[model samples]
Structures are given as structure tokens and as C-alpha cells.
Target: MTINSAHRFEPGATVVRRDIFGDRVWTAAPRRVIEDRGDTLTLAHWPGVEGLAPTTYIDSLGMDSPAARDAARDQGFADLASGAWELGSWRWRDTTVLSRFQAGEHFSVHLFFGAGHRPLHWYINFELPFRRTALGIDTRDLLLDLLVEPDLSAHTWKDEDEYAQGRRLGIIDDALHAQVELARERALELLAERQETFPTSWLNWQPATDWPLPELPSFNGV
Candidate 1:
């Protein structure tokens, strides 16, 4: 059940990702709205949530060698930065996440869950503040993230190299880079102060078992 409401989209509405570069439709992953408190919007992502992905990412998953996969993983982000990849399907497999976005905030806190719906940790996704689009929201991921322990005892910055690459490729401009730095501090402060945004009670949060998976539209065979 939702606490406060803003009615941006009804529960189970699809949210498309609008690219920061021009008006290109980069990705669209359909998610069910969990709550909408005007200030904060929550969306649920479950397994089989299909959306756009770099083809190299799909290819890496099947590689037999760990080194090869790692190399491919690195290349995938490079491909994304260069706009040299095809649009491929990416499914959220074997996990769940509740993404909470606050208006004008440069970061979104994503609560991750594992098997049996156990709260695993929080993923602080540093990105551009969402601009409402016709489909849902328009925000570009900054290629950097922070992973916080479930208990808030520890945190780590993830994908720093990729983020640096983003800077080199001009994907993240000077202004956006400064914004990310500020957002990083804000995320740490929230974690350090044990803010309500990262509620501990939600460690066991799970949706109704009967709820069906959200469907991804084909965009007329994109």
C-alpha cells in the first residue's frame, strides 16, 4: 500500500527512458508503480522485466571464460558511450528491485532483493533528474553507482572506471560531472544518517505474490 500519492502514473503503467542526448528513445522498461508521493516515486522491477540493452551485454553472459566476460563487459559500456551497439533485449533475471526517485534529485535509491524476497542492499544510481516524458520519465544513467549494505554498515562505489570512460567520451559533460560529485556526497550523508528514504523496515518488503509481471511494449517492433 502507498503512503502518500501524486498520481503521475497509475499502478502498472509503463515508464520509458528518454535519452539525454537529443530526443532519442534509449530504453523503456515497463514497471508497476508502487507509490507516488509527489516528492518520491516508487516503481517495482521483477524478473523478466525486458528492455533495451547493449548487444555485448547479452553476448557476455554466455561466455565460458571469466576473463572474456570481463573484457566484454568493459567493451559493452564503451559501445554504449560510442552509440555503436544494437538495441537488444535485457531481462531482469532472478531478482527484484524497488526504485525510488525523488523529483529534482540527481540520484535514485534502488532497493534490491534476493531469493525469498530478502532485502539485499541499496543501489544508489547517480543520474540526471527525471524529466517527465509522455511515456513515463526521462533520465540518463551517469554510469556510476554506489552499493550500500542492507544494514548500512558499509558502502562501495561501483563502476568508477566506466564512469571515467564516460567522462573521456564526453557522455558526461563538465556540468553533469560536478552534479555527480554532489550527488555522491548526498548519497553518503543519507546512508550515514540512516535516513527514512533508506528505511530499515523495508528489508522484508515484498509485493503480493499474486501480482503479475509487467509487460514491455514492442514500440511497433523497434
Candidate 2:
């Protein structure tokens, strides 16, 4: 793991995501760089922060119309399978407290809060390990995911159907699927061993009062 601080992102900077093909996916709202140790990058995103989505839904909408947004909410999986998408917009409404990625790991761990901002669960997102970029990070979403209880007492796989669909659509090739499967096992070990992503102190951590809701300046950055 690289242990350089100079190569890390500054606090309160926005980041963007790109597919393996280098196509824009979505740019996050301003996220607080909780820690950027080169080996492990931790970030935080609070509610009300607005981000740009690079999705071209199947409704023939460019993501500006309410109807398009509604359609995306309804049949997003189908649209993703089509592979004919474009730029759109979305706002953070969930309790995404902390997002941490280990260097060269094929997955990331995110802590989320529930109603009233209470500690909820840890979300393990399976994707390409992030490569640092000038604007932020470069990576794309894999269809598979895992959800673990806050105490790591229970866990479940998510988006199985979506993952299968991705395979059928040739979105996740054999090479990528191999990596995803390995990541799944590693994430499961963390759960079965009751190993939380971060120390217990992080479970109770709260957002700073001064952290403003971040806005996205652009979504095309690498």
C-alpha cells in the first residue's frame, strides 16, 4: 500500500466516476475527505448534496424532465442493460456517512445511517479498485453488492439479479466476474469474522456542523 499523503485528495472536494471504457457515470457532490492515506481513502457525503448523473434512461429523456426521472426510478435496471445512456442529475438523500476504499481492492466499504441519522449498516460495493485521477477517482460500478449489519452479525448479497443481467448483457465479462467473485469472498470474511470496516469509534462519528452540502461543478472529470 502506498503511504503518501501528498497524492491524496484535499478535504471537501468533489469526485467523479468513470466506467472501464472511460465513460462518465456520475459525479458525486462535494464529499469531505475524512482521510486520504494513499492506501486507504475515506470520504463522507451528507444529505442535500447534489451530484450529476451520467445516465441516459430508456424513456428518451436526457434526465432533465420529471418524467424521465420517474422512469429511471421505475425501470432503471432495464435501462442499464440497454447500454444507451447519457448525462443526468441526482441528489443524495440517503444517510451515506463514510465511504472507504482500500488500495487495489476490488470493493469499497460505506457506512450508512438510518432514520434520525442513526447507525444502520455497512454497504460493500463491488467495483473496480479506484485509480486516482486529477479530478477525483476513476472506476465504475459492478452489479453485485453486499449489506452487513452494523455489528457484522448478519449479511446479505444484493443486486444478484442485476448482476446476472449484467453478465447476460456482456457488461461484466469473465475477467471482471472473476475479480468480483474474489471480492465477494473477501467481503464475506469480514462479515463472518465480525470485522467492521473501521474501528468502533467511526460507527458513532457524526458529520461536522460546518460541512455544507456539496454541489457538483461538472460531471465529466476523470
The model with the greatest TM-score is 1
Tens-place lDDT per residue, model 2, 103-124, is: 7889988989867778898889
**Top-lDDT candidate index:** 1
Model 1 bad stretches (over 4 Å): 1-7, 17-22, 220-222
- Candidate 2, residue 170: how far the Cα is off, in Å: 0.3
What value does the lDDT take at residue 169 in candidate 1?
79
TM-score of candidate 1 on Cα atoms, chains taken together: 0.88
Error of 2 at 151 (Å): 0.9
TM-score per model over all chains: 0.88, 0.81
CA RMSD per model (angstroms): 3.6, 4.2
What Cα-based lDDT does every candidate model obtain? 0.77, 0.70
Error of 1 at 22 (Å): 4.5
Worst 10-residue lDDT window for candidate 2 reads 53-62
